[model samples]
Target: MSYILEILPSLLEGAQLTLKIFLWTVVGSIPLGLIVGLGLTSHFVPLKAILKFYVWLMRGTPLLLQLIFVFYGLPLIGSGALTLQRYDAALFAFILNYTAYFAEIFRGGLQSIDHGQYESAKVLRLSYLQTVRKVITPQVLKIVLPSIGNEVINLVKDSSLVYVIGLGDLLRAGNVATSRDVTLVPLILVGVIYLLMTAVLTFILRKLEQHYSYWK
Candidate 1:
């Protein structure tokens, strides 16, 4: 317990990093995922194929590998256009990986809508974009929210993975503290931090679910 207390401030700092990574990843991924999801279902076969390929590549590879590739391999290639520092590379990898998963979820949600709704919107003189925005998006959100919330919760934990790339997230802080004391107390403390984060996220997501449910 003393060891845990000793490392409290350090762990708190790391927790902030974890939160930053999680929040940024979610923020960047969601809208990008929506775009990818829409593109995957586009009428243009070439666009759909390209989006599908992107999703496949991101999903198919391990995230760690992607991180390494982005940070190391890309720089090795002449594509200096996307030079990324360690933390930046981790953030990029996290965003890309989560975006692919979210895209699939969004695609599923969009498809879950009845084809008749689109037809009805067209019959009522709604433009295609208007039908998607006004009619389809609302229904898709209802269906996808639970799943998206689950992924967001998962992201809170997965942010720790950034530590592998030298981004000092909560778990990394625990590792550093434990190394100094040769005690497992820091790890346990970090676990508590994670539990707190997950709990708070769960509560918020539940509230969001209820808020959206009213519209349904």
Candidate 2:
């Protein structure tokens, strides 16, 4: 236990960076995804085609490759126009990757809504914006919440991928401790930390699901 106490602060420090990446990705990706998903549903064929292509590229590629590209590839082609700090590069890549996924999820949720819902909103003379805001979005949120929660938990684990860029994170911290002490305890602790985080997220999401159970 004393050994755990000794390494706890360092692990938490790394966890903080991991948490930062997860949160920023969630914050940035959700809205960007919504916009892209709306574009996917737009009547404009060209716009939908372009957004679809973007989503395909984001979703088709590996996120680790995307991170490497953001950090290393863009600079090669950027001609001094696209330099990003390490944190910025990671943030940009994570947002780009997650946005594609969320866009598809949101698109699915949007498609699930019966056309009658829109017709009903139209009968009430709601504007397009009003219909989305007051009717469609609320329903979509409930439908997509579980998927979004899953992605959020994934983000927490995926944050460790930043280690590929040599950015310190919980797993990397464990690696450092293990290398130094030649013990497996720190690695086990890291796994526990991951489990604890996912458990908390699961509990919170379950509560959210219950709150939305009114639909049933």
Estimate TM-scores for all models: 0.94, 0.96
Q: Candidate 2 residues 87-134, lDDT tens each?
A: 999999999999999999999999999999999999999999999989
Q: Over the stretch 1-216, how does candidate 1's per-residue lDDT look in tens digits?
A: 665567899999999999989999999999988888888777899999888888999989988789888888888795787678988898899999999999999999888899999999999999998998999988888899999999999889888878667788899999998898898888998998899999999999888889888775
How many residue pairs clash per model? 0, 0
- Listed per candidate, the RMSD to the true structure in angstroms reads 1.4, 1.1
Task: List the global CA lDDT of all models.
Answer: 0.89, 0.91
Best by lDDT: 2
Cα RMSD (Å) between model 1 and the true structure? 1.4
**How accurate locally is residue 84 in candidate 2, as Cα lDDT from 0 to 100?**
89
